[model samples]
Target: MSDRYAPDVQEERRAAIVAGLVTAAVGFTSSFAVVLAGLDAVGASASQAASGLLILCVTQGLGTILLALRYRVPVTLAWSTPGAALLATTGMVDGGWPAAVGAFLVVGLLVVATAAIKQLADLVRAIPTSIAQAMLAGVLVPLCLAPVTATAERPLLLAPVVLTWLLLAALAPRWASPAALVVALTLAVLAGDDRSGAVWPGLAWTMPTFSIGAVVGLAVPLYLVTMAAQNVPGAAVLTSFGYRPPWRAAMLVTGVGTIGGAPAGGHAINLAAISAALSASPEAGPDPSKRWVAAVTTGTTYVVIAPLAALLTAVVVAAPPGLVAAAAGLALLTTLAGSLRAALTAADRAEPAIVTFLVAASGISVWGIGAAFWALVAGVIAHLVLRRTVRAR
Candidate 1:
């Protein structure tokens, strides 16, 4: 008999379905705008942006499904939200979209190589968690300020959305972000022009264009952020709950997925950090071994939702830019809070973490490299110097 019909398995199966649906809902509602904004920042056309979102959803969905089944673990995959935020802040490069695509491909290959090379993987793991969390917080600061900016600029339109989010967050935290999205959409339809009435997104392949600036500015940084902020933390989350997924295989799937989808505008896909906790924890099912079913269900939900990318892209493009930013900010508030808590938890790392957060939040760019990289470097140097001085004293 199927597991679903088995006497002892039915309850677990139902619990898994609930976990998976909730995870999928939270993941999609939280970061879709960041992806769109990132693509637009790099000069992708509306259809190209939609195609990227669709490709990302489909590839990550497939990767999650394959990895969960193969490993019998809750191997949830996600688009790199931090990477998207990085892209949004990085702005357009010399060769524009084509160059960005080239960077995406390079980042994917780097991830694959990182998995294959033991030392490289070890090096990634060696980066201080506090520094990484600080950098993430720094990168998120500007985006997180969007709600305030949106409220100032368009109070009538954005106020209700923010209020709804706050209300729901207090009452039903898991559903808060999704409800806020609904409020935003309803307001958009009522007040905004219907420019995207019949727009259907189509695939538009971009030829790769490589340059020193694009590689250093976009590719290297994208790879670093994806590994530092997403993959490493995601692994930790799973391990915390006692599921030991095959690390190399998980990286391989994400790397391959990223490379495959780059031509169609996808950036990086990695393991889910926050959302994974939802589907892999005890709340997912009483039996820990059955939690993989939640991940599989989440993956299936992503696949089913991939076709709606055109509609989402249309709505995003038509909506007020500030409103979209506000929604993204609202969605990420919890993540930001968690990152800050982690970054500041350790006393010795707190100063360097603050430095990193400030530099990244400043959004400075030098020699085409963004502030995220510089923030990480500065934070590490501070950490080392301060530690040595303390030892000498």
Candidate 2:
């Protein structure tokens, strides 16, 4: 039989398509609430948040398709989940939503600069992994507590969502968040929560305005977290799967995508870390070289579902208070646990990491700069001081 016609090859192709669809479905459903909350937290109106979500889906989807086909690698991309979480926690910054939009543009430029300027790349890389992870862990702490807090405030409304999440977490861990979201939306409908008028999709473009505080507080931290948490690990995952990722190209693509979507309220987009595994792993196909099909499928799936963003946003907007947060919170628990473990695992760096975590979790803002930036600053200082003391000893 010809190689193309082989039974095994056909099976692999089928597997790849299925894996891609699953990747898109899981990636979109799992953390989208976090994205909405982040945009809303930054002062985006309902239309703006929906626009942001739409642009995010469209840009990353197209970027993923382009990269995967060009490189013949399963190069998946995602909106920066950690960055969104940072926005949710950081709240409204110095110049409100316009400034936040400006910060998103800056982050995109920085990403492109990272690809083009070796010195800038080295500087970003020089930040200690422990400190970076600690900052992320710290930033995630409060958001991860949403389920507990929501339960306390609205037990009756959230109980079904929480129970659905718990049951699926045990039986089908990957579906837990998505399932919980469905339950929440269902409850919202049953309660007659209505926002049908806002379901039409359109760009809610905002003029970008720069400010010193937003650049430092929002852009800098967002860039670091997206790099440390998503882009870096995404490359590592592809490498582990035997494909040499085109790093420069990947950064340029995601960076440009980020910029293009910024005015529409999308925060940032980058290479996918967690969802990359769905299309890059052997589960996509036993033949390593053939997995790009899965990535193409993933991207296509994202594009197809991009129009639903407005509808989803309307449902979430009308959901019972704390319900969406509970779902988003549950989605992030695994990420939080992983970040905490990575942050504290090194005995030598424990103190600095702890310092970083505490500062971030404290949710402090000084001179209009948020805790994420300060956490990194404090962690680095602690690390330097401790190292010098040891050297003196």
Global Cα RMSD, each model: 2.1, 1.4
Q: Where is model 1 more than 4 Å wrong at Cα?
A: 1-7, 195-198
lDDT of 1 by residue, 95-207 (tens): 88999999999999999998899998888767777888888888888888999998998998898999999999999988888888878876776676766566575667898
Q: What is the lDDT of candidate 2?
A: 0.92
How close to the true structure is residue 44 of candidate 1, measured as C-alpha lDDT?
A: 91
Model 2 — which ten-residue stretch has the worst lDDT?
A: 191-200
Clashes of 1: 0
lDDT of predicted model 1? 0.87
Q: Per-residue CA lDDT of candidate 2, range 248-314, in tens?
A: 9999999999999999999999999988999999999999999999999999999899888888899
| Candidate 2 runs further than 4 Å off | 1-4, 195-199
Estimate the TM-score for candidate 1.
0.94
lDDT of 1 at 9: 80
List per-prediction Cα lDDT, in the order shown.
Answer: 0.87, 0.92
